[model samples]
Target: MSVSDFLAFTKKNKNISPKIRLYLIDKDKHYFINAGTLKNGFSPKLTIANNRDSVLSAFSKMAFLFDELIRLRIVGHSNESDSSELLYLLNLVPINRKIRTFLDWKVFGPEFTRDMSRLFEVRNDTVHCISLDEVTYHPKSKVSLSSMSGFKKFRTDFQKAWKTLLEIYVTEQEKLDFKKLSMG
Candidate 1:
């Protein structure tokens, strides 16, 4: 449904609690706003000086979606993160055979790992200025604009990473379903 339609439905729907309704509205708003912004930016009239903003926007959405997939796979529910909490949790997951296989076969080889590494670096250093590295450098005094080429790489990497995570989630879910059926 469209954002307006969703809003209208939410206004009439009384079964959902205020908190849930608000969350749903916010989720729709994120999609609506992102789609609109991307559409506007893609037009010939709009001169996008740098791709940093667009790349960051795509990376943010991809990261959130990746985190949500992880939450759903592990906890049977989804949660959003505003900081590095999800990244920390992801790091904590043991890189066992199953995960390794998933990353290799289900995803596109080591590209998932590479993309995620780039995404994390860009997210921390380029976007937030919060270094997740062991050797952190002092913040630059001047604002640095990201190169168009770098943004192109970021956009492509984010897409691969997001797609890999989604495929992993789907495969894991199928495995869960098989186990349930076998047990039943």
Candidate 2:
């Protein structure tokens, strides 16, 4: 929806509490300096906030699954090793450290893991109030779809990595955890 329409809707909806006042900027002042769009080649949508939420949600899930794969593959090693043990060890290591350890081990080639790195970049960009996402205005705000530039490649990369992890790491379909997924 256009900024004007969004403003109209916000005013109409009594339940909607806006964090910031909604106003229209001069169309000329609206600009997006999106290097992520060039890098990921993903376009932003007209419905900015929903698109952002969806992308964030998908990336969050993939990042979580990636971390789980690390725990099961690196720490758990086998079904008999104990799920509690896997989670306990996982509790000790931060996600960044885990990814670095996985890379250091070279269990999977960088080709498969590059996206993992990108996930961090994208996540950092999203989480840490970086430009693009930070510069990005609220939905229905008078700005281009700026924050969404980093998300285009995230889902695809995550899916590919998750697929490879399943193919290589999964040992059982029924249980689907350290017990079934252990490399040992």
Candidate 3:
């Protein structure tokens, strides 16, 4: 079964909450999983890590999925050596311009666009493992299990960002479906 179909099955049969399904099994599961996985077919799984590392990995995965969508749409291909480079290029254009023209971003408002931009920056920093004042490190460079205030804040922000992205994607799909119906 396709990943989306598998996810839908899980959502329906496993008693997983809709909130959990949306976060862990995105509607675009097939695209995201295929684009983000390595040759070994291993994709990042959200596990029980310290809050900071967990949030960082979650945000990075979110950003990567969005980048993969953009790459497919704009470049008409998915074999790019790196996705971060594509995101950096896309971010060079004004956020307003992007929100006006892109397939997904066209449905976003100014506030959503601004938040997404900020989230992208955070994703970049996190993926690079840049040391942040808010992140307390263990002696072996592992994330400290200790609770951190910034990690809490980041988790909240990541939820907001992912929600916004999912909403925009759904909006775009609705528009396409309506167009198809109208034409038929």
Candidate 4:
């Protein structure tokens, strides 16, 4: 819809208070160019350019872009549907196999892959668990990340994952574009 149409809707929909409407409009504009798609904030261009977008939001975007990487033939084989394919490969493929495959490809370095693996572990913990049990003691569990400082570290890890994934996505996109042009 046009800007005038949106403004008229905002006027009629009093439930969408001025602040809420403005925030939604700004959010849609910030991530997606148009609100006509009604994606509910589901765009694959989920890179953390600035602090405006939360780390979790970017992580969600990165997850969606995994399919893009698969489509581009960058991460996994398109034909391997059973388990080798990128589709839900994170849950199906063993960690060792994942490391082996990633090591073979130079798009990401060994150390970075290691870090990304750890990040995913944390992400899984955060996603799978229903709620975090309260920790009373000072020294928190090192592995589970049940404390505030641990949660902070999780955020840092997600930020790194988002940035690293964005770099890989851009590099692969350029390579694909060059290949298509050369082929043409």
Candidate 5:
């Protein structure tokens, strides 16, 4: 869509209000932007966008959020650096197929992964034009403003998935901390 459309969608999310700030930058003749916010009461400025990046910036921000959560040990993981892989490295699952089968969806759960996968699929449809129908109809679809509705749906789903992940991480961390303190 347009920058205004992105801003409007972000504005509707109350959680993002106090938590995030979006900035648009011109990098190498292309418009890039980054989303920044306070992390754990400390502002850790992050690059949420890149050159010519559009909707991918939003997806990247979601991934970064999960990465930060995992880094903080708010989410359970066998390793720390796997945060980025968990969010973006889809093929890593096949490389280490056992890790894929072992992912405790009972702990991390499946809802976030499923929603994120859908978001990635929609993004791929927008970017790669692998769908012949999308290649032929997208411009006209945008003219009719139907694409904006789909964009809104994608944005909503992404936000929901991010928020759900955050909640799960925070709750799990709290439980772990409580148990540790009780045992101590």
Candidate 6:
């Protein structure tokens, strides 16, 4: 099916959570996934807080999306080039090193994995602390606004980076025809 058709189908499923819905819609048109309908009684509540629970939840969601992309074959994995190590390189840099094992190297690359790791670091900083010392309001004017604190900056940056990465994944997907793959 076409990408738009897949997105339309996804939107029609009433069981999907609003957050996942927003995430799918916000993604670039190319990287859309046919997630199918959720089973009954599935509900995810995202509680906003400055705690490990909140951070972990967000990270988990991000990781899930990355895995889904790999499953869709939108990206390719890195080859070990050496079977002795049994090591696989990822197509995307991961926010956590642990995700490398989630898929074969042919689906996720090392560069992508590194970028993901950086994104996770930024996300973590945003979710855990608040400080007045790190943000500057006016870049050209060199006028620092006391009102914009570190937490505020982190939140803003995190959202932008998250959305951008989603878009990048989608755009990459558009270039490949998953139907050609035996698994797809």
Tell me, by TM-score, which candidate is best: 4
What lDDT does model 5 reach? 0.38
Instruction: List, residue by residue over 46-124, the lDDT tens digit for candidate 1.
Output: 2222344654565455554444445444543222242235447665653343235445554435755544654555555
Model 4: per-residue Cα lDDT over 87-162, one tens digit each: 5656565544554565577666887777666665544544544444321111223533455665555556666666
Per-residue lDDT over 1-184 for candidate 2, one digit per residue giving the tens place of the 0 to 100 score: 4433433443354333221211122122221112111111112211123354654665554455455556545433233335457657777776677667767777556655564665555555566553444523222223323523323334444456555654443332112332221111
Ranking by TM-score: 4, 3, 2, 6, 5, 1
The most accurate candidate by lDDT is 3
In candidate 2, which residue pairs clash?
79-179
lDDT of each: 0.39, 0.42, 0.45, 0.44, 0.38, 0.42
After superposing candidate 6 on the true structure, give the runs of residues whose Cα lies further than 4 Å from its correct spot: 7-51, 74-116, 122-148, 175-184
Return the lDDT, model 1, position 81.
42
Q: Rank the candidates by lDDT, best first.
A: 3, 4, 2, 6, 1, 5
Greater lDDT among 1 and 4 belongs to 4
**Candidate 6 lDDT score relative to the true structure:** 0.42
True-structure lDDT of candidate 3: 0.45
- The reply for model 5, stretches above 4 Å from the true place, is 1-54, 72-105, 123-146, 175-184
- The segments of candidate 2 whose C-alpha lies over 4 angstroms from its true place after superposition are 1-50, 74-82, 130-132, 135-151, 171-184
| Every model's TM-score | 0.41, 0.44, 0.45, 0.49, 0.41, 0.42
Better of 1 and 3 by TM-score: 3
lDDT of 6 by residue, 1-184 (tens): 4445544554464443222211232222322222323332212323334444554566666665555455434223212232112223333444465445432443445654554555466445545546323323322233222343534443454455456546554665565432332122
Residue 66 in model 2: shift from native, Å?
A: 3.1
Q: After superposition, how far is residue 97 of candidate 2 from its true place, in Å?
A: 1.8
